[model samples]
Target: MAAPNDVQISIPKNDIEEQGFKDFDYSQRAQWLRAAVLGANDGLVTIASLMIGIGAVNEDARAMVLTGFAGLVAGACSMAIGEFVSVYSQLEIEVAQMKREKRVGERGEKEEEREKEQLPNPMQAAMASALAFSLGAMVPLLAAAFIVDHKVRLGVVVGAVSLALVVFGWVGAVLGGTHVVRSCARVLVGGWMAMAITFGLTKLIGSSGMQL
Candidate 1:
């Protein structure tokens, strides 16, 4: 009986419920996970390689501990500065892109809307990367601290690094919604290869009577 203009459009309850059940936004998580996993993987590999290389040549506990501690401090600082610079550069590029978009006719509002939805935070990302690196680096350092025997310490460091790499890979995969086992295996192999290379080189150099 109602006039055509008087008829109201009603949204279906299913559609409304579907909106409420929408999957969680994973974009931000992917960003953080990339930075964090990279940081952790680097920290674990670098420190473990350093310790294992040193252990291969010399069995002095003092030397191993000192070297590891130095690597931890130096690596952490380097990672922080590097991450900050990298993220800041990315931010600059994004800003430049936005400016360019704005200069284009009839696309400024659309560009602005898109940019507004997700603005990258360089400072936050840098801090997160640095902290994650430090945390990851501590695993090997702590594992080495408990053992006085240099050879045993080296073994423990390798084990710790392997475990950490697997965990980080799995965590990253889960966060990014990928194949967890494949990611874990990839990281595990990579870490072992790095350590082996470093250890072999150091052993070769030491056996050649080269002191450095």
Candidate 2:
């Protein structure tokens, strides 16, 4: 039954397993990365635009820094609470789904545990979101905190916010397996528009007969 020209190809089990692991679903990590990216970008953009708006009307470094600080605290807390509630709701729904599917029987114990491992952790997500927001909001606050000259402080905040925006974009892109250049450009342009609009509108209002 043997032929000299016959050949058999065999693949090792180990190699098959390694390939399986390598081809894992990337969407699994998308949930966590989405929260982090959203929190960071929101914190940076909100505080930067707010500070720029104030700077457009007033030259006091103290007021701008204080406002930024207050915003950072409030933002971090809001992000944490929001993420916690959202993820907890998701977790509850998934748990209810497993129960409704009758996946909690004795024979299903192992499978149930495995499925639970994939569920989102509300506390972990909340902490990560809050920390990311605080870290992002700190960029502009630190940039404008020490500088006394209003114009220079404004310039530095803009520069620092720009740099941080690029960094956040790149980091988010890398984590999410996306195009870095496009992400960075989009983030930077959006940030610029927000700052420009806030500064322009606030300036117009201040320059007009609007007292305050």
The numbered model that scores best in TM-score is 1
Cα lDDT for residue 98, model 1?
80
Total colliding residue pairs, candidate 1: 0
- Against the reference, the lDDT scores of all candidates come to 0.84, 0.90
Query: Which sections of candidate 1 miss by over 4 Å?
Result: 1-25, 108-112
Q: On a 0 to 100 scale, what is the lDDT of residue 109 in model 2?
A: 75
Best by lDDT: 2
Report how far residue 181 has shifted in candidate 1, in Å. 0.4
Task: Tell me model 2's lDDT, rounded to 2 decimals.
Answer: 0.90
Task: Give per-residue CA lDDT, model 1, range 1-212, as digits (tens).
Answer: 89878979899999988776456566757656777888898888988888889889888877877888898888878877887888789878888888777777547577757777666677777777888887888888888887987778888999988999999999998888778999999999999999999999999999999765
User: Which segments of candidate 2 are over 4 A away from where they belong?
Assistant: 1-22, 103-117
Q: Positional deviation of 146 in candidate 2, in angstroms?
A: 1.5
